[model samples]
Target: MKRAGQQGWSTTEYLAILTGLVVLWRSSQLVLEHLAEHHDEFSWALMIPF
Candidate 1:
């Protein structure tokens, strides 16, 4: 649906947004792998304070 003054994203804008999302996804994957490999070190993270 097109709005009166709002326009669709251009090719460059679309590509930039896509690239940003890819970067974030890839970074999260890497962080998750690292955390998994060092799971023991992060055990304290499960502790909750009242």
Candidate 2:
């Protein structure tokens, strides 16, 4: 019984980690798309000589 409970807890932890990773991945993609769409403005910022 104790082993089964531990297994359930482990599964839940893994699922949570996987869900977090998926959310991060999707958000990163959205950010990239936005950057691409606004590349002209972004490029101008990059051109500023340090």
Off by over 4 Å in 1: 1-9
Where does the lowest 10-residue lDDT sum fall in candidate 2? 1-10
* Candidate 1 lDDT tens digits, 7-43: 5456568889999999999999999999999998997
Please give the RMSD of candidate 2 to the true structure.
1.7
Q: What is the per-residue lDDT of model 2 for residues 1-50, given as tens digits with 9 covering 90 to 100?
A: 47988999999999999999999999999999999999988898888999
Please give each candidate's TM-score: 0.71, 0.87
For candidate 2, list the clashing residue pairs, or say none. none
How many clashes does the backbone of model 2 have? 0
Give per-model CA RMSD: 4.7, 1.7
**What lDDT score is found at residue 11 in candidate 2?**
96
Stretches of candidate 2 exceeding 4 Å from the true structure: none
Candidate 2 structure, TM-score to reference: 0.87
List the global CA lDDT of all models: 0.85, 0.95
State the local distance difference test value for candidate 2. 0.95
